[model samples]
Target: MTDSADTLRARLTEAGRVCGGWCTVHIDFSEDRENPEGLAESRRRSVRDRLNRMGADDATVAAIEDALSTPSGLPSPFSRFLLARDGEVAVDEAVPGAARGETLEVGVLPRLAPLIATGVDEFPYLVVRTSRDGGDVAVHRTGAFFPESTASVEGRTDTLHKVKGGGWAQLNQQEHVEELWKQNQQELSAEVDRLVREVRPRLLVVSGDVKARRLLLDAVGQAARSIAVELDANTRSDGTDAARLDAFVAEQVAAVEQRDRADALDLLRSRVSQERAAADVGLREVVGALQQAQVDTLFVDVAALDGETLLALDGVPWVARPGDETGDAEAVGEVPAAEAILRAALLTDARILTATQQATGAGAAALLRWPAASVTGA
Candidate 1:
C-alpha cells in the first residue's frame, strides 16, 4: 500500500511540475464577507517573500500579475492576498492585440486543494494545490469568466469558528455550512455598502459541499457575484502532510484531466469534420480545402518558428512556398499568420490554438477558422 503521506507528496510534486513549476492557493471568503484585512495583507506579503526565497522567477511573477489584474474577470482582491514562495504570476503579455486572457501558477499548497479538483480548461487560469509530502496533486482549469483568488493571513491560521446562534447546534456539516453562509451573506451585504467596486466577478470556487456553495452564492449574490464550488472532503484542519492529501486529491485531478482531454479532442474532431464537409458541399475547390482558400485562419505556435504563411477564406493555414506567398494573399507573414489565426478566431467569435497538441498531451494550440470577421467570404 502507498504511504498516505508519501502519496500525497508525490501528487503535489507531479502537479507542481505539470503546472510549470508553480501552484496556486485560492482562498474564498463567503460572499459579501471580507477577510481579516490586516491579517490577510500581512500573510500575502510573507507568502510572496517566502516564494521568492524558494527561487521562483519572472514568468511566475507575471502570471500572478495576470491573475490579479482587473481585466481578467477574476474575483477582486479583498483587503489581503499572497503570491507565495513556490510560484509566480503575471499577465500574459504574449496575447497578441488586446491582452484578453490571464494565467497563474505557483508551488502547490494546502489552501488551493479545492480549486485543483475542478479542472476547468478554458481561459488559462489554473489553480494547483499539493499535499504534505509534496506528492499529492490537484488542478483546476479556468477561463476569462473564471479567475483565481488566493488568500493568506500572515500572523493568522485557518481555523473553523463554529457559528454561535440560530439553533445551529448539533447540526451536520451541511447544516453548519448553510448556517455559516447565512451569517456571511449579511456581512457581505454590509461590506458592499462600504465600496463602489468595479468589475465585480461572477464566479466563486470554494471547497466543501452544497452547503458551502449555497452559503457563498447567497452572500455574493447580494453583491451580484456568481459562484462555482471546488468540492473537497478535507476540511481546514487537515495537516499539511504531502502523502495523506495526495491520494484523495489525485483521484479528483485524474477525473478532471479526463474531461478536459475529451473536450479538446471533440473540438479537434469538429474542426476536421467541418473541413471535410466544406469539401463535400462546395462547388469550387477553393471553397472547401486549404489549397482552395476556404481556411480563414491557421493557429501555429508563437513559441515555435513556423515560417511565412497565408490564411484561406475559411479558417485554415496555407503555408506558402516563397513566391506562392504573395499572390491573392489577404494576410501574410509568419507572425501575422499566427495573429490572423488568433484574431480571426476571435473575430468570427471562435477560439483557435496556435499549437495543435492537446493540453493533456503536453503542448497544444488552437487555430481559428478565419483571419477576421471582415475578411471576404468569411
Candidate 2:
C-alpha cells in the first residue's frame, strides 16, 4: 500500500516525534561493536539503567524507554557522541581539588580587622601579638591556621620612676632597678602564668618601659616567652610601636612559612628523579588540578591584596570594591585571578610558599604535594 521510501520517511517522522526534547548524554565503551542491533539494544538498556541510577522518576524512565524503541529516523539512543575532553567534566561533581591538609597564614592587625572565630576546627592554630604605647596598646593577632608555629615579642619592660610612670621604679641604681625589676618580674610572672593558664596565647608581645617588658616575660616565663629585645636610640614607644609588633608577628610567621617552603621544595626536588613528574601552569589550571587530586603544593603572592580578600578563601564571597545593587543584579570589581588561586590553596590546606627568598633555589611561592607542581615558579 505504501512505497519503501515513503514508509522510511514516515518511520523517521514517528521516531523524531517519540525522541522529542530529550537531552544527549555521551557514554564511551572500551570498544565499538560491529552489530548495530546489539549495540542499539545495549544502549537502550544502558540508558535505562543509568537513568534509573540517577533517580529518574518512573514516568521519566518510561518516556526514555519508549523513545529509545522508536524505529523512526531520529537521532537514536545508540548514536555515539563526542566524549568530554576536560577531566573536570568527567570526574565526580562533588568535591574538587587534591585531598591533603595544608598550613595557612592569616596576618591581622587588630586595628584593621579584629580576630573573629574561624570555623575550621581541624589544622589551624592562633598566634596573637599585643603592642602598646603609653596611651593605648594596638593588639595585632597574626594567625597561623596550621600546625607547628610560635609567637615572639620585643624585650624591654624597663620603666623609670619618672613623673609619666607614676614614679614607681628605682631606675638609677643597678641593684635597685634589678631588685624592683625582680619584684615586678615576680608579679608579672604570676600574671603571665594566670593569662597563659586562662587565655593560653601561643605568644605574647609586650612593648613599653623596662617594667612592662620584664613583667610580661615574668608573667609568662622565660621559656614560654619568645622575646626579641628592642635595641635602638630612643627607648620611647610611639606610632612605630605597631610596626614593631607587626615585625615580631611577621618574623614568627616567616619562620613557619620558611619551614613549609623547605619541606615542599625538598619533596618536589626528590620527585625530579621519578619517571613522570607532573606540573600545572596558570592560576585556574592549578586550582582545577588541585581539585582533581593532582596538585601537591601551591605558591601564592600576597602583595597588593587586602587582608579580608586574602582570608575570604574560607567560602565567603569577597568584594574588592563597593557596588551598586539593582533588583537582582549586583556589580563588583574583578578580583585578581592569582589572589583567588592563592586563597584556594590556603583554605584547602595546600603547602604555601612565598616568592621573595634570597636564594636562587628558594624563591618560589607555591603549594606542594606529590606529582603536580605549580606553573608559577613562585
Candidate 3:
C-alpha cells in the first residue's frame, strides 16, 4: 500500500473516529543524503515545535515523537514522509518520490491533507517497451515503480534466412520471420492493454524497436494510444544503463504531468464562456460546488494554499470570508483554505489538478460533475 488519496482519506477518517491529539509530519528524504539522520532530526524538531503549538499533552506529544523517530519500514527510498498518530491508533506511510519539499503539520484528522492531495496529482503512469522478441511493462508514480505489477514477456525470434541465390526461398523465410514478429507484437499489445485497464495510468509510455513499437501501437486500442507518450530509447531484455534509463523515464513523466496540467487549465478557461454551468471560477464558488459534491475536477493554483484561511466547524471545512458565521454550529478552528478544499474534494472523490503556469485570479477553479445551477439553484 502506497499512499494514495483514497488511502489517506480512509485513514484520516478512521483516525477522526478516535478523539485525541493527532500529529502529522511531511519530510523530504531526498535532501542531503550524506547526512540523512541530520535531515530526519531537523524534521523531528519541526514536528515537535508544531505539536507544542497545538498545546498537546506531554504524553501524546511524546508518543508522536517516538513514532517519527522510528524506522518507516517501507522497502523503497521514499522522498516524502507522512505519519499521523492519535494515542494508540497510528497511521504512518512513506510516499515514494513525490515530495518536493519539507513540511510539518500537527492537528486533527486531516492534518496531512495536503500530502494526499498532491499525491493524487503526481499522475502515476504505465510504461511499455517492446521489441520483436519480447517486451517489458511497469507502473510508475513519481519516479518509483509499484514493483508488484512490473512484468515482462519473452518470445522466439526467427534469425534463419536463405542465401541470396535462392530468391524464392529467401522470400519464404522473410515471410515466416514477419509472421513471427507480428505474433510477438500482438501478444505484447494484449499484455499492454491488460496492464492499462488494470492500472488506469494517467499516461502511457511506449518505446523499443521502431517497427515493433509501431505494430504494437496499431494492435492496441485508440484509447491507450491517446495517452501514450512515445520514446526513442529502446530498452533491452538484457539490462541497459540504469542511470540513463531513469533519467529518460523521469523526463517523460515530467513532460506528461506538465501537459496534463496545462490541458486542465485550458479546459476550465474554454468552458467559462460557452458552458458557464460546467465551470466555477474563484475560491468561494469552487467551495460551494465542492460542498454539494458536484465538482468533477478541481484546478488549484500551485500557490493557492499559502496564507489562505478556512474555518473548520465541527469537522466540516468551510472557506473563510469576512463576517462568515457558523450559525447553529461552533467553529472548531482555522485551517489552510487549500487543505480544506482538497479534503472536501477527496471526500467527494473529485479529481485534483494543481496548475503551476496559469493562475486563476482567485487561485482556484473547478469543473463540476453537474451543472452549477443544478447544485446551487442559480
lDDT of candidate 2 vs native? Answer: 0.36
Candidate 2, residues 1-378: lDDT per residue as tens digits?
Answer: 112212222222222122112222333221234785676678669766775565544564555555445543322222222111111111100111121222111111001100011111112213233222221222222322122433333334565233323333433445555555456445545544544554444444444555545444545555346533332212234435545654555566456555655776665556544654554433444545544434456544433223322122212222112331223323222334444444344335444444433321332233335444443532
- Which is better, 2 or 3, measured by lDDT? 3
Q: Candidate 1, which segments miss by more than 4 Å at Cα?
A: 1-181, 185-204, 208-214, 217-227, 233-261, 267-319, 325-350, 354-375
Candidate 3's residue-wise lDDT over 217-332, tens digit each?
A: 98888768988877766666455544566667778777777777678777777777765468898888887787667888887764655787766555433333445653564455
In order of TM-score, best first, we have 3, 2, 1
For model 3, the stretches where C-alpha displacement exceeds 4 angstroms are 1-20, 35-78, 87-101, 113-124, 141-145, 157-172, 274-277, 302-305, 315-330, 356-358, 370-378
Per-model C-alpha lDDT, please? Answer: 0.33, 0.36, 0.66
Ranking by lDDT: 3, 2, 1
Relative to the true structure, candidate 3 reaches a TM of 0.76
Clashing pairs in 3: none
Number of the top-ranking candidate, with TM-score as the measure? 3
- Lowest summed lDDT across 10 adjacent residues in model 1 is found at 90-99
For candidate 1, the lDDT comes to: 0.33
TM-scores, all candidates, are 0.32, 0.33, 0.76
The superposed Cα distance between candidate 2 and the true structure at residue 131, in angstroms, equals 14
